[model samples]
Target: MKKIKVMHIIGRLPVGGAENLLLTIVRNTDRNRFNLIVCCLDKEGQIAEKIRQGGIKLVCLGTTRVRHSYRKIRRLVELLRHEQIDIVHTHLYKADFWGRLVSLLYGVPVICKTEHGDVNSFKNKPFYFKAAEYLCFNKILDRLSDGIIFISEAQKKEFEGKRIKMKNSFLIHNGLDTKRFSSSNKRRSQDRSEKLSKNNIVIGVVARLSDRQKGQSCLLLAMRKIIERYPEAGLLVIGSGEDEGRLRDLSAQLGLDGSVSFLGVRDDIPELLAGMDILVQPSVSEPLGVSILEAMYSGLPVVATNVGGIPEIVRHGETGFLVPPKEPDALADSIIKLIDDPAMAREMGEKGRETVMSGFTGDIYTKTLEDLYVSLLKRKCRNRNYRYADLFEIT
Candidate 1:
């Protein structure tokens, strides 16, 4: 059987949930069935080298200026034609915009877009921005794209609430290599030397310092409240972004500078998870948290906001506590609960690991995606005509 040629298009290779999810799918997919290549629409970042080093083909179009989309699109269309790509799967916003546009012109057999989040993703956008979602995404691209994948059912429902009727979409929960986190500590010698004091409880968050969405400001407030009750409790913030300066300033203002450590963009996430007693995802809206999964798999209790897909994963009492979004007091209270009862926290962490092992693993994720590919291809073979009712039954 001839292997199906598939190309994954993304804006960049930055350390993000969508980028990491793409890498995981590429790493786990069966090569015998699919010839996979990654096309970075914008520039490459930290993970690009990792993808290239893995012996998979990677193409960077070097799109810098706003006007370069035309040139990039032309180059991409030419590449897709030359490679005879059967499927063009795009992740994130920029890629979804340009990649799908190019694929439509090039006439690829299958075009799929994965929604990392839902309509809530554009909550605080300007008037024109909301118009783009209503017109560009809902009107034009919804019909053009072959299959739309939602990371969780909550995400799908949220998208539907925007009065957009998706023809071909499905819910495929993200997965990871559970074994990676389950392994013994792989923290560098320097990282291994650093440990929370005997009387101290370490709470950690692994997310970018973004301007919005990630409620890092609220987290700082929560930390301020936490430090007063449990002076022995400390917070570690991993990952860097544009909002770091502001967040750092907020930490100083809140007097949490002493207890909170902002360790920016570490590649060793599992190692970081090992150093912490509990993981906190204080995002105002999370599609799904890979860090939370990694923490749970690492046998660490989680305290995440009850928003978007988070409730689907963190089963409140079972794995971790889910507090209402933007509530500093509630967030602080949950973290304090885990800090006070180490035994209960440990038990929750163990159960969290079982959840990942049973339902979320790299193998399960790859297989589910493979099944989707086969099903789509079969549909294409059976119906040569363009119109199909719904592309996803991911239930």
Candidate 2:
């Protein structure tokens, strides 16, 4: 059987949950059965280099302006025709819109979009912007796409609550590179121990520094309260974004400058995660926290907000604690509990590691995705007029 050519389209390869997951999928995919290509609608971001280094064919259109959707569609048409892509898989908002539109127009055999974040996240925006997404993006996606993949059940429910009645939808959780983390855990444990004093307990928050969505400000408040009791406790703030300056100012204002260290856009995430005793994700809204998984794989207990797909991952008192979103006091109380009982924290961390290694590893995630792709392709082949095998034929 000839390999199915799959072209994944995304806005850019930034170091975020979606980008990381995409890279994982590509890395773990069965190359004998599938040919994977990546197309970036915007300029290549940080994660692009890793994808290229893997010897994958990557195309960057460099469509910088948001208003250049027409240009994107045109370029996509040319690329699809040139490459004879069998499947057009899209991620992120801009890619979903332009990729699907061009794929549909180009008569691509199968087109699928993965919803990385909750679409209803735009509900709080102005009426005009919300209306545009409702009519143009969501409605079109629901009607035209071959299948929609939701990373978490909570994300699927949120879309359903908004009355998105797509024909085929799937819930496939995001996965971690467990083998990498597991090995790194053993090697770094001693290093981490050597770096921290006997009295110090380090807490980590690894996510984009966007305060509005990530709620890092709330974590800062919680850290302030945490330090009042455990003065030696330190918070490691990882990842950078638009709100870094404001968050840094807030850290100083709350007298947490000494306790909070902002380490932005790290390549040594596994090493960083191993150093920490506990991980906290204080997002006002989250669609499956990947950092939490990374921490879990590194054998660290987690404390995250109980919003959007988080509860699905965190079993609240089992693997980690789930505090309500935007409540600094609740965040503090949970961290304090873990801090007070080191034994329980270690137990939880072990359980969390077990949880990820068993079900949420990159291998498991890739297998599920490959199965879905093949199943969808087979089904489409039977019913649809387009024949993928014919695309490879010479006239």
Candidate 3:
């Protein structure tokens, strides 16, 4: 059988939730049945290098500005033509606009776009920028694309709230390599046990340090409250972003200089997660909390805001506690509850790990994606009255 060619276009391969999800897809995809290609609209970042090392084909169009995108569109079209791409999947705003436009014009058999952000994604953006995105995403792409992949129910409902109908949409939850975390935890358990004191509790958060989107400031405030009770507790802020300076200043101002450690962008996340006692996500708006899942896979209880798809994953009292967003008192209370009862915390962590293992693994995620691709392609072929063998010969 001729393999189906799938090209995924994205703005960049930065270390992010969406980027990491894309990497998972690239690595676990069934190479025997599908040919995967990644196209970056901007310069290739770290994730792209990983793709290249894995022997996957990657195209980097080094066009930095929006105006340069037009010239690169022709290059994109040429590449699409040369590769005879059967499917075009896009991610992020830039890729959605340009990839869909080029693929639609070039008459690609299957085109899909995954909406990674929730409705609150544009709350801080200016009216003009928001309006432009609405026009492109809702008005154009929603109507033309073969299918829309929503990573969370919250994201799907957000789009539906705008009364934008997505008939061919699919709700596919994001997944990660649970075995990687499990193995890493096993390898580091003895070392982690020796390095840390039994009395000291470590609260960890993994998100871009942006207060506007991630709401790390709320976590800082909560940490202040947490310290009054658990003096031995320390918070680990694991990520880098534009808001680092302000967050660092806030940490000092809150008298949390000794209590908080701002560890910048890390490649050793699985190992780091092993050292954490509890994971907290204080995002004011989160589409899906990938870090929460990661911590769960590492057998750490999560205390996250009850916003977006977080509620879907966190079972209030089962896996972990879900508090209201930006409420420092509530956030602190939940974390304190966990700290006060180690047995409960351990039970929650065990249940959370079971949740990820049962429903959320990279293999399950990739297989679902591949099945979606095949189903969509088969429908297209049926409509065109073309056989599977004839699909490869289509000019």
- Kindly list the per-residue Cα lDDT of model 2 for residues 1-395, writing each as its tens digit: 56788999998888898899989988888888889999998889888999987789999999946577678778889999998888889998778777887898888988998998776666654465477686766677657888899999988888877765766888899988664564758555434333333547899999998898899999999987888888999999999999999999999999988899999998789878878888999999998989988988787889999999888878899988999999999999999888887777777888887888888889999899888987878777778756555544211
Per-residue lDDT over 1-395 for candidate 3, one digit per residue giving the tens place of the 0 to 100 score: 57899999998988889888888888899888889999999988878888887789999987747667678888999999999899999987778778888899998989998888876566554465478676665457768889899999988888888757779889899988664565767444334333334547889999988888799999999998899988889999999999999999999999999999999988788988988888999998888878998988887888999988898888889989999888999999999898877777877888888898888888998899999998888888878775444745322
The reply for model 1, stretches above 4 Å from the true place, is 122-131, 185-197, 385-395
lDDT by residue (128-242, candidate 1, tens digit) is 4477776766447767778998898888887877756887888789998654453564332123113322545778999988848889888889987888887888889998988
Give lDDT: candidate 2, residue 76. 82
Q: lDDT for model 3, on a 0 to 1 scale?
A: 0.85
TM-score quality measure for candidate 1: 0.91
Deviating ranges (above 4 Å) for candidate 3: 123-131, 134-138, 182-197, 386-395
Please estimate how well model 1 matches the true structure, expressed as its whole-model Cα lDDT: 0.81
Model-by-model lDDT, in order? Answer: 0.81, 0.84, 0.85
